[model samples]
Each structure stands twice: as structure tokens, then as C-alpha cells.
Target: MASSAELHQRRSAAVARGVSSMIPSYVSTAGGGTMTDVDGREWIDFAAGIAVTNVGNAAPRVVEAVQAQVERFTHTCFMIAPYEQYVAVCEELAALTPGDFDKRSALFSSGAEAVENAVKIARHATGRPAVVVFDHAYHGRTNLTMALTAKVMPYKQGFGPFAGEIYRVAMSYPLRDGRSGAAAAAYAIGQIEKTVGAVNVAAVLIEPIQGEGGFVVPAEGFLPAIAAWSRAAGAVFIADEIQTGFCRTGEWFASTHEGIEPDLITTAKGIAGGLPLAAVTGRAEIMDSVHPGGLGGTYGGNPIACAAALATIETMRELDLAAAARHIESVARPRLEALAAKHPAIGEVRGRGAMLALEVVIPGEDTAAGPAPDAVLTAAVAKAAHELGLLLLTCGTYGNVIRLLPPLIISDDELDRGLSLLEQAFASSL
Candidate 1:
């Protein structure tokens, strides 16, 4: 195994400069809440592969399922030679996703692909050309999704001539706006009505809990209000739960928390126990609107990925990981709140279940001046935590939010250790 420095040198030469990695070292093995790098240094994993390893890395059931699947065959391309695992995965999705209505699903290779398909389904079903999105939201990196995404620098800087008819509106950001859910919703609805016009809209797409956009949890009634407006306007309400789905938020989907039943929901990240799999689950009529040949890719639902997804769903059920996410909230939220109380730099702590964040801002009178993001301090704290063997991830449109996404299966002791390391990092960085 190469040393971290040697591997980084090799990677710089071989890997594209555009591809970014959060950590300095290369991992050799990972399970539960920690990963060991090539140098044999172990670091507690709070990032959870950016919430992809919700069932924990290499869980026994997922590993067994993947091995059995590989033994049977790796690729048959479901479009050509469909397999049982693919069907089974879809069936599970129908049963597990938020809405109780008769639903159908289409499998894809990434969250971005799933989102693109959802938008396609929406436009086809409604016979409308316009799509609605929110500020500080992240759908994906694909051209269409990049248009949907709000960030400019890293995601959409060079990518241009993006898909048209995608409209952006203000989201229900309580910390910044200090507006009630209804007021925020009214403002957003007014913007849509005045600019995009409800008649022209095909879909109102948003992250139930905005990911990459700082884990911004909408005000209590915000999501329900948006869903209601979308319903009244005859537009599809699409929940982009790509980062907050599959028990990451203490529910099968975050929309469930608000009791908002979306017409379509896009999911990935935690769906397949780290394998590349994504899905768009929604109403049957809407999904069926597309022609038979219109909705698949050659590698859309690979057998191995499907197998992993089925096993992952089963593991989530068997372990009651939704409850585990709640437990994580119980344990982590207070600590984060306490950290905020102690450090004036931490302007807010937001999010639900296992998905949480600390918005770093300028301390004291400057905080009152405005929500001035303290990106430098955020970078220092993340860097400190990484060097101290606790991996943390920073996000936000302003690049001033520290997000914690520990694997659901992480032990109490491991979580405590990570929290302590974070505190130390805060003390040192501040």
C-alpha cells in the first residue's frame, strides 16, 4: 500500500484536476463509523460518504447480497435482459416511498439522473415546459440539474447554456428570513404566479431538507404550503430527497415529516448501501405518461446495484434505522446546540434526525449586522478535525456551514468520540 503522500502524488498525476476529494489520505478499509487509510491511520467517518453509507459501509447483509449478485452476473442491463432484483427493487420502492397511491419507479445510476428523469416525467405528464426550483437548493451536476441547482462557483461556473425554462425562487430559510412558513410560502407562490405563471409550470421541485445548501430545514408549514400550491396549480410536487431520503431523516422520506405527499420523489445516496443507484418514485399515471422507450439508460438499473438496493432496504427495515436516525438526533442535536451556545461563531444549528449542520458566521455584532458567512473559520475547523482523525464536511452556498452526516449504524461511543473531536477542533480553530 502506498503512503498517503505517495498516493496523493500518483493521484495528482493520474486523476483529473476537476475531481475533488475532501480528505488528504486514501482509504484502505471502512466499516461502521470509521475508515482506515493506506498509512493505517484510522479516522471516524462523520461524512458517511456524503450520506451514501447510511446502513454503514460494507454491512454484512449488503456485502453478502453484492457477492451473491456478482456470482450470478454483474451486468445484463435491465433494459435489455431485465432481472428479478430490478423488479424487486422497484416493488420495494413502491412500498417504501412517501405516498400511498399506486406508484411506479424508474431506476438510474446517480441522484442527478433520477432528478432529470423526474423533471422529464413532470413535463411529459403536465404538458408544460416550465420547472420551478428554490434558492440554495442542489439537485445534481448534470446540465439540466445544474440549471436547477443554485450554487454558481463549483457546480455551475463553467457549465453554461444550461437547460431553459427552469425558474428559481426563494426558499423558506427561517434563520435568515425570520418569516413564518405561511409568509415565506406566500412570497414564493407570488413569485411563481407573477413570473413563471402556474399554468406554464410542469413541476415545483425542491429538497425537502435542502442539502449542499446548508441542510436548511424549511419552516414548519413551508413544505406543506408549497405542496398545496403545486396541487392547486395542477403542477407536480417533486421532492428531491436525493440527500435526505431512506431513513437519513428519521422517516422513509423527509416529506413524511411534514405529511406532504409529493407527486414524485427523487432518491439516492443512502439507497444502495454505497452502490451507485438512484430512483424516482411517483404516481403511476404521471410515470406512465412517458412512452415505453423514453425512460431508461443502458446501465440504469444494473443487477448488482439493484441487489445492493434490495439488501439495503431490507437492512433498513430489519434494523429500524429510521429510529436510529431519531436516536442520532437525540444524541447529536443537543451537543451541537451547546456548541452554538458556547461559540458565537456558530450562528445556527439546523436540520432533523441524523442530518444536521452548524452554520458558521462572523461573531458578535457582525452576526446581527447580517448573516455574514465565516468561510475561513469553517475551513479551519474542518481542516483541524481532519488532521485530528475526525472527518467532517463543510457545505452551504456561502461555504460557511459544517455538516455532520454520521452513518446511522455508528455506535454511541464512536459518535461521542467524533463529537468530542469536533469540539476540540472548534476550540482550536476558533
Candidate 2:
């Protein structure tokens, strides 16, 4: 077993020094909902590789599919050879996504790629030059997606000359703004009307539940309002479901709870169960708007990822992970909420289904009170959790929110164990 120091030194040499990790212990392998480092130490994996392994790491069916696909043929490029798995998964996405009407689906290699393509499709369909995005929204790192993304520091840092025709507005964060969902939506739309002029906008992109900005769930009526505004403006409504889709939010997609069908939906993360794959699924009309040959990359829809996606979608259905996500919420919310009640530092706890977070705000201070360093105890809580064998992440524009996105397949005992550690961390921190 490698010592933590030895592992860290080796990793620095082998992997890019720029790659960031919260844990010094390197996970060699994972299963179900937990992972072990090369040092033989185990940790409860609440991160799920930032919500990618929802079907549980190394899911049996997904493994088998990948193995089978690799043996059959790893790549012929779907745009060139075109495989059955690609079509099958698209079919599955069409069925699984919220809308019942005719839909079209396209596969890509990464979440960023899916997002960029969705924008391109929207632009081509609407013949509009402008796109509206929300502040604190995390679309991706690609050039276009970087412009689409809301946060600045790391993602947008030094990468400018971003795609033109991009505009940003604030999101509905009650803890930070003290505004209701309706107010946030109205304010955001007003920004568009006043600054960007929605008349030239091709699409309005949003995260149903903002993922990188700390699993922030907008107030009720917030998303519906935006969708309504977009419809009236003749702009495509794009829901970036890369993090919130595939039962992470207790439902198939967070937008479903609000009864909104996005014109173009970008999905990834759990879609292929830890495989490098993403997708854009939406109404046939909008998707077909793109001319043939408009979208296709060499490794866009690798056969291996497609096979894994097929297996992944099948596993989610057979195991009913959507219901499992609801079960997770039933288990986690009460325990986490109890922790919140006991700790005044926790200003708010909010989310839908298994995607939830507790905002750690300094008492008597709002989350937006000067950059979240002195106030939110997020760093302390995260440090405490890691020492006790639990992984933690602090997200949000201000870095004041700690979100939990564990695998929906985690056992009751595991959830209780993780929560117990969390409670102990809270008690000791105070």
C-alpha cells in the first residue's frame, strides 16, 4: 500500500499537476457507492465523480456492455459507420426524457460538447444570434460553453475572446438574494429585455438545479417562468441536465417537476454510468433544424460509450433508480435536515430528490456578504468530513454551499453511516 505522501508525489509526476482533487488518497477502484485508495483505506463516496456514477461504480451490466463493445469494435465513428447501440440509446433517451411528443437525440463525447452543439442547433433553428445564460450557471469549459458558464475564477479564467452573442443574468438564490423564485425569474428576464433584447436571442440556457453553483434549486415557479418567457420570445429553452438528469433529482429530470419540456436538453454525468458520453435530446423540430453534417466529431459517439449508455439506461430502468432516488431523498433529507437544525451555521437546506445541499452561512451574515470566506464554514466542514472518512465538496458562486450527490443505489446502512460521520463533524466543529 502506498503512503498518502508517496501516492501524492507519484500522482503529481504521472498526472497533470493542474488536475485538482480534494482527497490525497487516490482511489484505485470503486463499487456500488464506496471506493478504496491504494493505501487500502476506504471512504464513503458522496461525490460520485461529481454525480457521474449514479448507477454505482463498475455497475455489472455497464461493465459487461463495455467489455462486449470493446471486443466487437470500439470505434467506427457513429457519423461514419453508425451502430445500433447509438440509435438504441437515442431511442432510450427519447423514451426516458420528460416529453411525450416526437423527439430527436444526438450523442456526444462530453458534457461540454453536448452543450456547445445544443447552442449551435438552437441558433440554426431560430436564426437568432443571441443566447441568454444565468449567472452562476455551469455549462462547461469549451469555448462556447465557457461563455455560457456563469462562474469566473477557474473555468473562465484567462480564457476570453469567448463566443460572442452571449449574455448573463442572475439566478434565484434565496439565501443570497432574499428574493423569491418569481422575483429572480422576473429580474433575470428583465435583464434580458433591458440589456440583450430577447428579439435576437436563439436560446436561453439554464441548469434546472445548478450543479457547480452548489446544487442550488431555484424557488418554485422560477423555471416555469423562464420557459414561458422563452416561448413568448421565440427562443429555444435549453435545460442543461448534465448534472441533474437521469434520476439524480428524484425525477428523471428536474424540469419534469415543473412540467416544462425543454426545447433542447443536454445530459451527461450519469447517463452512461461513468463513461465519457453526453447527449442532446429535444423536440424533433428544433433538433432537425440543424443541417446534416452540422454535428459530428471523430470520437463523438464512440461505440464503447454508446454500449455502456445502453446498459446504463437499461440498468436504471430495471433497478428503478428514479424511485431509488426518491428513496435516497427520503433517507438523507431528514438526517441532513436534523444536522441543519442543530447547527445555526447552516442557513438553508434545499434541493429536489437525491440532489440536495446545506448552505453553511455564518450566523447574522448573508451568503453574498463579501465573498463567503469569513462567513460560510464550508471549508471547515469539508476538512472535518475528510478526516472522518467522508468526501465533501463546497459549490456555488460564493463557495458557501456543501452539496451531497451520492449514488441512488447506496444502502440504508451506508447513508446512516455517512450521516453519522457528518453529525460528528458538525458537533466537533461547533
Candidate 3:
């Protein structure tokens, strides 16, 4: 077998330059919280494939279901020959997502597609063109979603001209913006009313807990306020739970934590236990607004992916992985807090459940001025963790937040070891 270095050389020649990876080591196998690279090195996985494999890398149920499904059938194209697995996954989504109303869902091949369809549904249902998003939000990389996204350097630099009528507003980032949740929401709503005219808005889309935008949890009352306002304005409130869905956030959906029921929810990532399945689930009326042939792709809801999703959801319930995520937070958050107390470079420790983060900053004496983002230090620490056999991921608009997205099923021993390596990495980097 080719070594990591050899594979990396081939990858450099073959893969597109726009596509990037967190690490160079090619994985041979993975299960629970650990992965073995082709070179025979074991790594404690803290990234969870950017929070895709919430059930772990090789969950038995997911594995068995996929194997069985591949044998039965791979793809019949749900658009052509609709299957039970597809409808079953949608049923699970309707039951699991944060809503008590009659709901419906449409499956897609990627998160971007789900977000796009959500916007399409909102527009079709409301007959409005304007979509409102937040600062530091990351919807996706597609043309419409790229316009919805707020970052510039890597995700959106020179990627325009993007879709129009997507308005960006201030998000309730308590660390940087000192306003309370209500105050922040008022400001955002004011901005929308003044600039975009809420009457003209089709949707107010946001992440329940911002993911690639630095795990920025909007302050208390922020989400609920936004949802309420969206409803009053006759705009669909979309919670992009793509990263925080499933058991990653200690709840089936993060919006539940805020006690807000979004009109539409876009989900992927952890939904199918690493399978390429995404969904746009919403109220029945809104979802039905589109024509019969509107919301589907050739590979949308493939049988194998749908089967994996069913197994993944079943495994989550059987294990009560939402509780497991809370357990992980109980074990990991205090340790992270202690590390922050020790290292001034750790400007903040935030996030919930297994989805936690440490915002790296340049230490300064003035506490009121706020710490400056230290992307260089963040990169160094991640590199150190990788060298120590711990896989880490970094994100944020500033590129300074070290996000920890461990599988909900990660064992205590693996979690502790990964945290220990993280501390050592910080020590070396700082």
C-alpha cells in the first residue's frame, strides 16, 4: 500500500487545488473515536469529519445497514422509482426535527443543496425574493449559499458574482459584541426593517449554533426572538442545523435548546452517519408550495444513503447519544475551562455538548479591549496536536477558533487522551 507521503504526492497531482483537507494522513480504518492511517499510526479523532460521523466513524448499525443496502440496491433514483427508505428517512426527520406541526421533507445530495432548496421553498411559499442571513454565518459553498455565507478569503473571495437579494446582518456574538440577546436581536431586526424591509423578506436563515463560523452560539433569547420576528414578518425562519443536528448538541436539534420552533430546518452532516445525505424539512404547507417536480436531484435520497440514515437514527435512539453528548460535555468542558484559565492565549471557551471550541487570541493585559485573534497560534497548535496523534480542526472567520467536534460515541478514555494531547499542543504552541 502507498504510504501517506506517496498518496499525498499523488493527491497533489490529481485533486483540484480548490479542495483542501485538514490532514495529509490517509486513513485506513476508523471506529468510535480513533482512526488508523495507512502508515499504521492511530489518531484520536476530535474532528469527526467536521461533525459528520456523530455515531462514530464505523458505527456497527451504520456499517451493517450500508452493507445490507449495497447488496439490495445502490441507486434507483428516488425521483424516478421512489423507494421506502427515502420516505422512511423523511419520516424520521419529521419526527426528530424541532416542530410539532405537520411537517414534510425533501432529500438532497449535500448540505448546500438542502439550504438551496430551503430558500427555494421559502421563496415559493412567500412569493418574496429577499433572504436574510447573519454575519459570520456559513450556509455552504454553492452559488446561492455562497451569497448567504459571510466569509471572504477562502469561501467567497473572487467566487462572485453570487446570487442576489441575500442580506447579511449582525449575529448575536456575545464575545465580540457585548449586547445581550434581546438587544442583539433588536439591532438585527432593526437592520432588516430599515434596509431590506421585512415585508419583502422570504426567509430569515441562520445556524442555531453557528458551525464553521466559529461555533458562535447566539446569546440567550436571540434565536427565539429571531424566529418570532421571522414569523411576524411572514418570512420562513430557517435553522441551519446541518452541523448541530442529531446528537452533536446534546439535543436532537439545537433549536430545541432555545425553545424556538423554526418554520424550516436544513439538516445534513450528522444526519446519515457520514453518508452523503441532506434534507430540507419544513411545515407541510410550505413544503407543498413547490410543484411536484421541483425539489429533487438525480442522487437525492439514494437507497443506500437513506438506509444508512435510518440505521444512524436508530443507533442514536438505542444509545441515547444525546445523553452521551451531555456526558461528553460534563467531562470535557471543565477541562477546557481549566486550560483557558491557565493560558491567556485561549481567549474564550464556548460551545455545548461535544461541539466545543477554544478561540485562540494574542494575550494582552487590557481585558476590556478584548484579545486579538491569533490564527497563527491556532494553526501551530493544530499542527502540534496532529504530530501528537490527535486530529484537530480549526475554523472561524478570523481562522483562530480551534473547534472540537468529537463523536458523541467517543469513549471516556479516548476523549481524555485527546484532550490531554490538546493541552500538550497548546503548551508547545503557546
Per-model TM-score, in order, reads: 0.99, 0.96, 0.98
Candidate 3 TM-score, true structure as reference: 0.98
TM-score of candidate 2 against the unseen true structure: 0.96
Q: Candidates' lDDT values, in order?
A: 0.94, 0.86, 0.93
Model 1, clash count? 0
Per-residue alpha-carbon lDDT of model 2 for 1-430, expressed as tens digits? 6777898888878998657889778787888768888788888878888889999999999999999888998789888888888888889889988878899998898999999999999999999999999878999898888998888878898989898999988888766676788998999999999999988989999999899977878888899999999999999999999999998988888889999889889999999888999999999999998889998888877889988888888898899999998998888898888887888788778888778888776676533443243323687778899999998677887777888888888888888888888888778777
Better of 1 and 3 by lDDT: 1
Off by over 4 Å in 2: 1-4, 367-376
Per-residue lDDT for 358 in model 2? 83
Clashes of 3: 0
Candidate 3 global CA lDDT score: 0.93
* Residue 278 miss distance in model 1 (angstroms): 0.5
**lDDT (tens digit, per residue) of candidate 1 on 1-430:** 7899999999999999999999889999999999999999999999999999999999999999999999999998888888899899899999988777999999999999999999999999999999999999999999999999999989999889899999999899988888899999999999999999999999999999999999999999999999999999999999999999989999989999989889999998999999999999999999999999899998888899999999999999999999999999999999999999999999999998999999999865355425888999999999999999999899999999999999999999999999999999999997
Better of 2 and 3 by TM-score: 3
Structure candidate 1, residue pairs in collision: none
